[model samples]
Target: MTASPPPADDLSPPPSCPDAAAPAPAQALQRLKVAPAEQPLSAAQKKFNRLLARVNSLERQLEQLQQSADALRAPHLQRMDALRQRMAQAQRAMAQLLHARLQRPGLTAAQQRAVRALLRDLVHAVPPSPQPEPEWAALRAAYPRPVPAAPSPEALQQLLDVLSAASGETLELSDLEDAGSPEALIEALAERLHAQDEARRAAAAERRARRKTTARQAEAQAQAQDARSALRGIYRQLASSLHPDREPDPAERERKHALMSQANTAHERGDLLALLRLQLAAEQVDEAAMARLGDARLQSLCLLLQRQVGTLDRELAEAEARLAHELGVQVRAADPRRLLEADLQALQDELQNLAEGMEHDVHALQDDDKALKAWLREQARLAREHERAAREMTGFGFQF
Candidate 1:
């Protein structure tokens, strides 16, 4: 059998034996496929992933906050409007009672002073009549409205100094002397501020234009281009995979169409994270692939995400500010909805107490003269204290 051994080219054993057809060692090795080892994320890549996760969390939180704010706004506004109406009615009733008491004969000097003080407080509360009643006109003549003191020269100069320092321009009192009243001064200051703002904006624009032509700007442009390229690459991959036209099934095509729309929108907005998420959704890329991205690409993505984080932060701050302004309360960041609800409840309670107090005052003032006189004496004493305090504030150069 050895003398009759097959030639080198015919080395295979006969097919009659099961072991004769077994593969050679090299052939068996070739058939066993070994997967390449995944590359571990570098420090920068890990940082980028952390930032991405933070952005995702912020996006969800902001959306939820906005939804909650929207849901609370209508009810809050409605309740506020109702409370304001009640307050107005209570104020009108109080004003009418005071006016009637003032018209009565033999009122003590203290009572008269208290009535006038109450009337002055009601200036904003009571709607002005186009035609004054005889009694009201007489009452006005007896106790003419007090003229407010003008802003002192020192105060005006101080304001000018502050404005000059802030605006990087010289502001003299003579420039705003024509602004006699506080309201006029405010209007003049607003105009000056607007002009200064415009000047600053123009200067900034010019500086930006100059910067755009510099080497540093060129580097920035290059970096921006790289970031855009990374974003476009992900968007393109998503587009290719999720294009509805490529899908055969109706349901799959519709789904693809939706994803394609989302991808398009994300691309238009330069939302790199959103496009990357779309890539994940379509199975065009995985976390491992993302981690394996080149350093330059990862850096660009990180920069984009950093800017997104800044924008999200500003949006969150602005949203909270708006909510706080609307609710007339400071919004707590940790649990804004709960805090807003608590503040709203407190405000309702306060308004209720005010309404009840006003009602009780009306009844007391109408029925009991002795009680009313005692109240008037106390009010007059408080008014004197307030006037003294005002005089003291004025002495220190503070204006009302």
Candidate 2:
């Protein structure tokens, strides 16, 4: 077969390869050049930097608060589990007691009714087993059928109102009717009580605010306002400094764009530290002049710092209160790591005691049951003997 001729373009000479070690393009080199000499940071900029440091410190405080919250959460959850287990143990103990009481043979109809009434009195009694055996029949007769229906919204609201009145706290009226069981209703009522307590505290704060402010309080309020103004001024300065649209060079514009985005985010989040860091990185602030802030600006910064610290403290307090509420315990100076251990131990101890009591009760019940059975057998034997004696007497035709 004849080989096809090569294409015209394929015959052209290939281009020579450059040295692997060649320097980058001039444009890239220009891009890599160091930025222009830094300008001195203005008085306002220095104040901003100081405020940013305070903000960063506050952020760290918040982080530590969150960590404490997490630490508290684990123990609180363990305590809750312990409580649940305790409840289950209590239920099991009660069940065993009921089973023991119900196991007595030869119970009359009236006696069975009385056992059932006792079982019915227990609100959280367990359901009976479904076997046709005699032992199970007694238990089955005693187990109550508490097939609960969902409460109507109006009735739920009424119940919530009553609970709220009894608790002396505002109860939230939301989806409470969906509490499908009585136990769930109780839990919902508990949550509402907690919410109400928080609401009442807020109201009390409002009431306290109605009181005349002392001179010190007035001065502090003014300082707080000044701190807020200073923060706003610093944020505006950062925003103006990093306006990307004003940058003439594309590379500088790109850099400004990123910085501006960061500034915007920091402003939105009130993150003074991030904005200050961006300014420092961009060489917009003069480090040497950062310490040259005026006395007035320094005072303002101090006020800002005070306000920030107070805010952090308040947040931490709220977190602690929330944790305390979840654990159903007062957390006054309590270590977050070990807060729930005591409660859990107490509950476990209670459970142990309950279990022991139940065991004792079960043994006593079994002994009583054995005695009852023996007595019933004896009574039955006596009845049979009496019948046989009567039959012999009747066959002999003897008149009494």
Candidate 3:
């Protein structure tokens, strides 16, 4: 038989030689690749995927919101700063004019009263000085009472009462007395409110931490072991496969090093979705494997995804709230940019009108005594009306 020589096409091995009939390594690998369309996702898997998508969507929205807010804030702050400077300069000029008028001689009682009222407004509008002004003593002697009698004892008491009611705490008049002036008192009140808010947030955080600890304890008594096992299994598989030190090829090892770093981070964070994504990226797992996860593991992963969604939701809300506060407008989900622009334009117009009005008042007071008197009379009438309204509202003269 050997001497006859077999035909060149006759390449079949003997039936007893099973090893000779084995497939090539490349062909064996091809057998392991399952078509994704073959597996239909279960309800739990679908829910997990949906939650993961929601988290991604929320994160993208937050990032875009931050970028948009920054873009709007830059120019808005610049323009507001310019307008504020102009207003400050005008206020200073008016203050100077009022002070000069108060020093002039031969003034009637009514004129003196008018000048005092205007000067009182200027004093209250300006920040208090560390040292008293030179004219302060002279004016106090001439007036026989505080000119700018703002934040009086009754006013301070009312403020304390309001704050106490709001905060559900008792506040006495002495609490704000250390501030020394109306402006300082107002600042002190603001500081107190901020401190109260911070305390409330801290308390809330502590409560949440306690609740989390209790939840973790409960989980330990139930399916915590299974959840931990699932997480560790995925991490271990990734670590073994992506072990850069085990790889000989330099380029492949470098690529794997980066992947290994990400895997380590996801493991430490207990981020199931991120680990799943990394596994998919490494071709270690496919959609079929993801869909076929154990019921307990799938449940844990779905819960994690839900929590991630909630956290992202809260973050997005806080970012939007901050933007709304900075813009001084209520930001709706639809067309927030347009709303901010409209509000900003209105603010600009108001500022322009205020500047014009201040300029007109300065000119009128400087040029004509009759104009000043007439303005003073109008102010008096307005004050009487305001006082009457206050009496009607509160049945007391509680200066707001």
Candidate 4:
């Protein structure tokens, strides 16, 4: 076979070794694959690094959160701040409403009195707090608070107008309803009576609970006092036994000295329970109360708190009085304390009136009930007499 000359290459240079410059198509493909293979791995490494960074950030956040939670474990000023804020908000709203009402000219002085009366009535209906303040504070800590409803736009405007008219001017009214109208009076009396009854019941219940708490505290205090008295007796006995002066021996003197020191320390520290335990170990019992008079921690704390409250109350009162003096002529205007006192006075009056009205109502109801019972008894007696008469007529064989 004739060997044909090799066909001339067209439109391209001769293929070069991939190691030099140009590469075969297969080698080029392999090179491209190598870079992509590295790319996927690099992407995975980047993702892993991001994941590690996120984990580290979360760890830091968790540690911070733990520290914050631990900080909240103690009672904090923030709680007091929040309470004061809420109280301030309520006060501001009340002051604004009053100011607005005072600005309105159309409202009469009596209508204003009536408005105060309504506010007075409503404030009393908030119910008396029977529990201790600390207990109430604790309950408030856990309990969900009620959200106040927003007033309707029209009602808000009306309130604003009424408040504006009420400021600085006197109110006057006419067409007063007759106080002697039985139906109207009865309805009013009934409502007042019911409210009064509730208040009395509340007061009585409070008095009872307070008595129980006081009794418990008193008993606990008595026990502690007795323990302390015993401690003194024990101390006297121990001191007699451990007197360093009585010990002629040097080492025994040192030992007695130590015991005496311990006894003194314990007595001064008021470790009555420990002292009592020591007394029991001594195999001789003394009348705890007869041993000596002493103090109780619970009673002491109660006294301390009472004194603190009294002092704080005096300070607050003085501050308020000074403020009032400064605003003497305008004390009623913008006096937070005066408003608080007025509110309190109004509530007391309402509660007293309601209680009296209820008592009267209850008495009246009881009287009516007694009258009805008497009438029933009379009717019953008449029926019996008629039956006897019928029986007597039958026995006499007479037809009427």
Candidate whose TM-score is highest: 1
Model 3 ranges with Cα > 4 A deviation: 1-43, 105-118, 124-280, 284-286, 324-335, 377-400
Residues 195-236, model 1: lDDT tens digits: 888999999999888763878878888988887777776676
> Taking the tens digit of each residue's C-alpha lDDT, what string does model 2 give over 1-400?
9966533211111122111221222322222222233656555545544554555555655565567556656765675566556554555555556556566666776555654554554424433335455644454455756567877878777887887788765665544436765468678778877888899999999988998999999987787776677667666665666677877888777777776776787666554445445544444443332344444555565565555557666776786687568755554333533545565456556656765654554455554655544544554576689889988998899645
Pairwise lDDT winner, candidates 2 and 3: 3
Q: Which of candidates 3 and 4 is the stronger one according to TM-score? A: 3
Clash totals in order: 0, 0, 0, 23
lDDT, candidate 4, 143-260, per-residue tens:
3334657557565445445533744222222111343332453455457667888999999999977774677788866765654554566577656656789778897687667656
| Best-to-worst ranking by lDDT | 1, 3, 2, 4
Clashing pairs in 3: none
Per-candidate RMSD vs. true structure? 13.5, 22.6, 12.8, 39.1
Task: Report the Cα lDDT for residue 384, model 4.
Answer: 86
Candidates 2 and 4 compared: the better one by lDDT is: 2
lDDT of candidate 3 over 299-369, digit per residue (tens): 66666667677777777778768877887666543355666678777877788777777767887788466
Give the TM-score of each candidate.
0.72, 0.42, 0.57, 0.19
lDDT of each: 0.69, 0.56, 0.65, 0.43
Over all chains combined, what TM-score does candidate 1 have?
0.72
- Best first by TM-score, ranked: 1, 3, 2, 4
| Model 1 bad stretches (over 4 Å) | 1-40, 126-174, 177-219, 243-254, 377-400
